[model samples]
Each structure stands twice: as structure tokens, then as C-alpha cells.
Target: MADLTGKRIVVGMTGGVAAYKTAELVRRMMDEGATVDVVMTEAATKFITPVTMQALSGRPVFVDPWDPRVPNNMAHIDLSRGADAILVVPASTNFMARVAHGFADDLLATLCVARACPLLMVPAMNREMWGNPATQRNAAQLRADGIVLLGPVDGDQACGEVGSGRMMEPHDVLQELIAFFQPKPLQGVRVLITAGPTAEPIDPVRVLTNVSSGKMGYAIARAAREAGADVTLVSGPTALATPRGVLRIDAHSARDMMSAVMGETPRADVFIAVAAVADWRVAEASAQKIKKTAGEPPTLSFVQNPDILATVAALPGGPYCVGFAAETEHLDQHATEKRQRKGIPLLVGNLAQDALGADDTTLILYDDQGRHPLPRQSKLAAARELIAQVARRLPAGRVPTLAARPAPGSPSAVPSAPPSPLSLP
Candidate 1:
């Protein structure tokens, strides 16, 4: 199903070149199953015709407060009545100032004042204009009034000067909209996640790595961020963009991943180890590329890599740890045993052949209470469900502070046998 299914959105367009982008936003919202009602200001009509927005929304665009099409002649009141949210795209400085002080002179501004739903504004203007003290104060006032400002992210502006005040792209706006509706169960929580396949060097140009694409881990990071968690991702090599609002650290080898995880674990409320780390690494990797042999292949020695999950789980009063097991056979037996061996509160299991590098797969959560299978679905969906489960298991009150826990590499932080399993909800 689409993310915004059955959502009703009222899109308000103010005067700006970014109105072209809003056309795409309206179409994309509908594609995601949201019915959009476009409301344009007189200045907005000057930039982009109401006909264009009307064609995209498949409804008459409202410009005048007294739009005769509305049976009650109160377009502002009727348009925003049942809206899930009212988004003012490319909200001009004039419009923002007007709304900031409760001046409902225009149709869109009037609707905003009358609407009961949440209000989101996307600012788009020249860098100098956005940097102006007056504009800043207005922005602050709007925020203080419970208005959500999506972004006027720093980038090239239409006036050609590069700085702040660029409107977020249409696709990004759509993502923010989707996230705004998600439950913030992980709010104020710090999450540390490891993803992708760690590469262990055998030579300068040769390394051993698994087939993990990091899709599932990245999805979980996105889902967790959407749920309002402060997320940090320790990622192995992958060709994927960092999820918006996530701090990503790159880890190439198993040891690299272990070090990164250790450094971040002290601050985390929850730790999810999902990377397909190589179990072993070359004991004495060649300084240069290994030369190809004509008669026989070169023999290489191997040493076991440090177990990241077990190490974190062994930390006294550490973050709640969750592990992932991808098995080719005997999933239940292997997954349950691994969870116990690692001493983590939760373990997610799936068939390696079915899940690695795939867009969708079935996930089974193993905890103190036997197996709980989740329906096969997209990685993002599974990630959201997993995050929900993790949220439920978290203990009440704030996570332990840094002062309350030993530093990761200190002598007192040495690994011990896993303590009794964490109590699950």
C-alpha cells in the first residue's frame, strides 16, 4: 500500500519560482494516495497559472477568498475543514510575515488562520532575504506558534547567489510529509546501527566480503529517524545515499566496524548489528597485491575477527542489543542459538538466499518468547515493524548517561559473559 493512503492534504502556494516544484509535489502526493486541494494566492497565479495546478489536482484551484464555486462562498473555511495537514509550498517572505503576526489578508493566509489541522511551510527565497533579521524573527515566531518549517536548506537560489533559502526538492518534501505522520515512539532515543558487508583485506587490491547490499539496515535507519530517534549508522561499503537526518560512519573491515560500534555504543539507547561481517580476516595481508601464480594458488592464513555484537552485549548496563542472522538452513535453530550466544535481547532471522540484496523478504523476530514471524514485505516496512518492537521493549525513563557507564575501551569495560536475558515487553 502507498505510504500516504487515504490522507487529505491542502496545498497552499504563495508567489515564488518554486511553484513549479509544487506542481510535482501535488502529483506525487496523489500518486501516494493522498487527495490534494490546491490553493493559490493572486501572486502565485502570476507565477504559475491556476489552470496548471487545477489539471494536476483534478480539482478547481482556489485563488480568491470569495471563489464562487464554493457553495458557502467561504473557500478558506471549506477547503481546510477536513485536511490532515495544510502545506504552504514555497512560502514567500511576505506570506510568512503575514502569517507570523496573524494577518490573514490573502485567501491562503486566511485558510491557515481558520484551519484546525497542522500547518507546514516550505520557505523559498533569495539568500539575502532569508538571512535578513526580520525574516529570521518571523521564522522563529512561526515555529513558536506551532508551525512546522520543513526546510529552506542551503543551496543555490534562483537569484544565483548560493547560501541558505533554497526550497527542499519535491521528493524530499514528500518524504518529510510522510515522516510527519509517523509515530515518534523512538523520540529522544539514540540508535546505533551497523549495515552492509564488511570487507576484510587479503591484499592491497583483494578483499573478502559478503553479498549484503545494506538495504535493510539503511531502511531501519530511515525508519528509526522517522520515529524521531537520533540515529548513527556504521555502514560498510554500499552505493546508497545516506538517509536524511542520519549520521553515517564508513567501516570497511570487521575491525573497522568493531571500532566504530564501540565508540558510539556508550551514547546509544539501542544497538542493532545488521552488517554481514566476515568471520575471519587474512592473518598477514600482503603489503602489495598478491601476484598471480602459474602452477599453484597462494596459501593464506586466517584469524577470527572480533565479535561486535557479543562485545557490546557484554558491556555492563549497555544499550539493548539486537542481532541479525541470515541462515541458509535451520533458521529457527540457528537464530535462537545465535541470539542466546550473543546475549542480545532480540535477533532478526531470514533465509540468506531469500533476503541478501533483495528488496523484500520475510522477517522472524526471536526473543525470550519463542519465534514471532512477520509477514513478507518491503525492507522499509519490516524496518518500521522492527523499530516498533524495539520501542516496546525499551525500559521506561531516560537511557543511562555517559557518566553512569564505563568508557568503551577502559579496563573496567572488559567483556564478561552475557548477563541474564533482558526482559521483553
Candidate 2:
């Protein structure tokens, strides 16, 4: 009934006090588009039993390898063939040993050893039991055998003990399972993004910068990485730490921002202007702090910075460019004008009051298809939606479109080669 419509999953339960958690896992996997088949280890039935699993998964449970009811009909082969993947939750130390040693003494173990599709295992046990060197070695072997190992997070345990080795919560495991099934949609695609707030210098010790916290942009970078895009994050000064697995080029002034973005635009498949770049900068920054004389406020001259988005879009056969607009009024009109004038394929506009320094945002995507409103959600979710739209709209490649060399005497400077593509996916 949830989003999963066509996926087929095989859920195996093993002996552990946390075995009950597997029922919720099966239910969630089914709700998210999976048809689940449940199998229970002998010891697991002693904890939560199989009738409950049968009711939750809507499939009869399998416990013994020699059980004639399902086997006479070639059910084992059928069950193995029907699933897209196999998942073992509450993978106890004993079960891990059985799997590692290739022992198929039970139905669940037999199916695991027999499945043709991919296998994923989520370990859950007491901290001391999980930390056993034998269990660690078995897990390493599983990884080497190409099994997907979901997290066994560190936290308090059910046995009145506290340390490493807790099963990841149901929701988090669901996310990992979904991500595991997702196609590398952005494979080999290069994306360039600008983030954070550029500083407008007033003096050595004072600078004017907006309240842009860079959370939204950083979230987008992570989502893009998850989507399998090689992402380059051109960032301005922000207090936030750089997200691991992203290429970050720091910029302080509008000039530095342009240089970072320009250097990475040519080879990019997509360019996102998420940075709140200062429109104007002090005409001349004081090399040192200007001391106050306790008199009238000093005047500072300002000059318009180079329009980076427009400059990149004007490149001949440039990358597919997208711009962001943080507007409070006349949002549609302004976004439409910016999209047309900047010649960008897409413009993502959100209310500044709702978006600035926030972790959630609602966005209106202005593109060739007109406006599509994305309801307020986590910045990561919004980023995924935006990227999916971009992917759907991406035209099949015809040629490698490099940025145009600047014409002689042009005001905007040409950027160097684009950053080499890298992705967490």
C-alpha cells in the first residue's frame, strides 16, 4: 500500500531477542513496494514464532529444509527464483557462523545458500557477542562473498549492556534497503554546484554575509552523491563541515566563487547555482581594519559582481544549467524571468522566509514543462526530486559540450578545466 509496487523480497529471521523486529521490517518492505516471503530459523521460532510472520508478510513461513508441504511442489526453487533479493535480519552470531561455514541445516539457511538473487544481512546481537572475533571474521567473509551488510549501529543493548552492536532501527534499515535497490540513476554524470554565502568585505575584521547556513546545498550534494552523480561543491565561507566524499573548493569573494565554478563548468553534465552569492562587493577592500573615529558612519563603495550563472549559460554548448531563487514576493514572475534571461533549463524557487538557514523547503521548479510544486520536505528529499526531474529531462548525449572560450576583451573571465567527476555511489 506504500510506494513499493513491483519489488520482490525474501526476509529471513534468525534467533535473537531482537528477532521480533524482523516482522516490522517485512511489513515496511512490503509497504514500500515489495512482495515479501518469510523464512524463520529454528531458534528464531522459539522467540517470536512464525504464525505472526506469516500474518504480517501474508506468506506461509518456511522453517525446515525437508518439510514436504512446500518442497514437493518445488517450492524452494520457486521461492528462491521469485525473490529479487534475500534479506536476513537479526543475524545472530550462531546464524552468521552457519552461513559463513556454508551449512544449510535449516530451510532459511538452505534458501540463503540457494538463492540466485542478491543477499543482504543485518546483524543484531549483544555488544559482547557481536564483538567476538569469530563473528567479525564471519562478517568479513560475508562481505567478501558479496553480501550486502547493513549497519549494526553502536548503542545501548537489550541485555542491560551498552556498547557497539545494535540492529539499525527499522526506518533506517528501510532507507538502506531502498537505496540498495535504486539504480545508479546518475552514473557517470558530472554535476557542478555552488553553495554557502559569499562574504562582501567591509574591513579585515568585518564582512557582510547572509544567513544562508549551507545546509540545503550540502544536503543536495549528499543526495546527488547517493543518486550516483560525480559532484563538485564550490563553497563559500560557512561554519558547517564539508560533507565527506565531495570535492569542495572554498571561496571567500565573488571573484573566488566565479573562479571555482568556472573551473568546473565545462565537463559538468549539470550545474546548480545553490550559493547565495553576494550581488555586490566593496569596490576596494581595506587591507586592514579601519579604526572608528567615533563620528559619522564611514561610507563604502560597492560594485556589481560578475553574474556567474548568466556567464556559464552563455557558453556555447554549455552544461545543462539550473539556478536557485530565494524570493518572498512575485516568486513566479521573478523565477520565470530569471530562467528566460539566464537561459538556464531549470530554476528552483523557494520562499526565503521558509528556506533560509532551514533543513526543510518547499520548491517550485520552473522548467520547460512550466511550474511543478514540491511540497515541503527534508532538504534531502527535495534534492532527490529535483535530480529525478533533471534526469528525466536529460537528453541523450550527442557530443561532449565544453564551455566556450571567452571572446577577446569580454568582461567575464573564462574558467579552467572542470573538476574530475567522483561519486559516493
Number of the top TM-score candidate: 1
Q: Which residue pairs of candidate 1 clash?
A: none
RMSD of 2: 9.7
The reply for model 1, stretches above 4 Å from the true place, is 398-425
| Number of clashing pairs per prediction, in order | 0, 3
Q: Global lDDT for candidate 2?
A: 0.79
Cα error, candidate 1, residue 326 (Å): 0.7
> TM-score of the candidate numbered 1?
0.93
RMSD of 1: 8.0
lDDT of 1 by residue, 80-154 (tens): 888989999989999999999999898999999999788889999998889999999998887666677877889
lDDT tens digits, residues 1-425, model 2?
24457888888889888887887888888778788888788889999978999999888888877667764755557678967788889888888889888987777787878888878788998988888998888877776565667768888888889887899878777766765554446655788889999998888899978889888888777667656567899999888876544788899988899998888887787888999999998898899998889898889899999999999989888888889999989999999998999988889999999999888899999987789999999887788788888776776662233223232223222112112112111
Q: Can you give the lDDT of residue 117 in candidate 1?
A: 82
Best by lDDT: 1
